[model samples]
Target: MSDWSPLHDAAIHGRLLTLRNLINQGWPVNIITADHVSPLHEACLRGHLSCANVLLSHGAQVNGMTIDWRTPLYNACINGSQECVNLLLQYGATLHPESDLASPIHEAAKRGHVKCIESLAAYGADIDYYISHLGTPLYVACKNQQLDCAKKLLQLGASVDQGKGLDSPLHVVARLFSGELVHLLMDFGANAYAKNAEGKRPVELVPLGSPLFESFLEREGPPSLMQLCRLRIRKCFGIRQHHKICGLLIPEDLKHFILHL
Candidate 1:
């Protein structure tokens, strides 16, 4: 590993005073490691918000990418640093997926960082940004067994069926034999009978004697009319307008049900 510079050390340790001194002494705030990892990247990745602020105030590039194409914003989300994420967004970091295989939302979901996911969603990161290896952010959340993050994504209108190829989110969780996750996905409108590229339903992928497999087998047939209606309404709102459901004059219980709160 390349030795981190004094500036990188200051940022990593959250020593804002030392970082400010270096900046004042004309040290380049954007100086990077051999892998092109900058002080800002280190600060954000370490969740050192104050140090990151100092670097950003000194004109550090918020969108600078590492040698492998990960951005500071991506690092912030990977570290679950909501503070750093907000600052990076405020300074104009690109919220969309660039050349990197994983977007900021994808990183947050992969790490089960619900707060970071919320911050990214609040800032308009595409909730459905797909990476072939990781699938959509929702798929990554499920693959990582991030139940809370998966729930949050569903509430934000993430498609529960949009995994890579035909490996629907349900299929992935079922293969893991997580009955809880499978049920949760179903509640969010996942189609239990949906087949993968191999033309197999989630139930068929489970271990032969697993209770999860039996549960999926017993849930045969299509969703009920009421369930289908609710799913359709949820999709109509989608991620961008789901929050508006909160303003309706409906009763709190109804509102909660509609928004999956």
Candidate 2:
């Protein structure tokens, strides 16, 4: 119950002079409201760049997390406010690791905010940060048909096949019949041959009568039995190959199976 809480609220509502006066009076710059959201979150959400700048200059914690774990940067990216995003970055907001909910990069890419994505990337946000529902930022971009955002993420080192779900970004794009995204993902080294947990390759996920289905049939060619076997083993274990391989391994090509036994 500091005298600054109301001033912080006013900052969130974009009352510039009031916010400046409070900052000048040495008000606590990083105070979170009752909900644990810092004034910075609200200012950025509402695109109040001036108020945000005042808070940042007054020593606000740029990356303060809310009760729900969202940061001011996350809100700015979600709203696709490039100026706010840049200002937050300039003020030293750190991108939190990807969790169950989407990261700021995912939100920016999903919204097709190229500048926001770039700003986040330049600020060291993980371009490939994977999240639930949206998968990687690139995957979300592709799913939303945000080609430019997908391209930017790829350029920033995002993998086209970095998720744990049944579909790679390419698979999702193919399922959505987005030829551009499919091509982009393939060019970025998406393993079209990669299978999801269901034993279905990206090609197999395409609907039977769709143009993507035809394209996949033509481009998929064939996967070797070794590849298929590895895919099956990965699916059986419910683990990604990139994770450490545990237990036993057989030697024979066809008999080379992992044993949890």
Candidate 3:
């Protein structure tokens, strides 16, 4: 195996001073290893924000992709490095690279990085961006049992019913016997009767006679009037203003109710 270069070593080990010194001495900041990995990718994958900033300052390619098609932003999200993610975004890194598996949002959701999800969303990442292997970010979150990430996506207007084949988000949660996820999805208006490719609704995937199974059957009924009203208000606000609805002049309880605060 080829040894890591000095810049890669500095970046991966979080040695900001050494990295800056190397850059100042006219060392190439964008040098790649045998694996086509850049110093910026190393700093980001390891969550070394200072090393990453120094590398970027020295003119490192912010959107450099590895041989496997992972960008620095994607690496940062995989490691749940919020600071690294923010730094890369500030340096004009592409929010959503056309990658093989998932985008930054998918990486964050699969890893349960709530702050990373929020940062990506704030920077205009496509909330519903889908990967063939992972479905949507929300679908990946539910499949990976990342409740907070899934909830955040729902709040940001990610469709809860999206998925391919036998694995809609609701169907995946049902197979895993996650009652809490089921309730949360239902609260966000998931279609319990929506059939998968195998012609099986989510309830059929649940254990035959458990309380969790019973809950799905109970939830199959139509939503209450209050839920319908909340859904309409949320639809009116849409993704851009759902989080901002609290600032409007409304009843305090209603504000909390609307935002799910």
Ranking of candidates on TM-score, top first: 3, 1, 2
Best by lDDT: 3
Candidate 3 residue runs with Cα over 4 Å from true position: 1-3
Per-residue C-alpha lDDT of model 1 across residues 118-174, encoded as one tens digit per residue? 888888888888877778988988888999999999898888889987899898898
Better of 2 and 3 by TM-score: 3
**Least accurate stretch of 10 residues (summed lDDT) in model 2?**
252-261
TM-scores, each model vs. reference:
0.94, 0.73, 0.96
* Candidate 1: residue pairs that collide: none
lDDT string, candidate 2, 34-56, tens digits: 67777788888888889888888
Ranking by lDDT: 3, 1, 2
- lDDT (tens digit, per residue) of candidate 3 on 47-98: 9988998889879999988778889999999899999999999999898886
Sequence-dependent TM-score of model 2: 0.73
Q: Model 1, residue 175: displacement in angstroms?
A: 0.3
Better of 1 and 2 by TM-score: 1
* Clashes within 3 Å, all models in order: 0, 0, 0
Model 2 regions more than 4 Å off:
1-5, 25-27, 97-102, 132-134, 221-261
Q: Please state the error at residue 234 of candidate 2 in Å.
A: 28
**Candidate 3 Cα lDDT to native:** 0.87
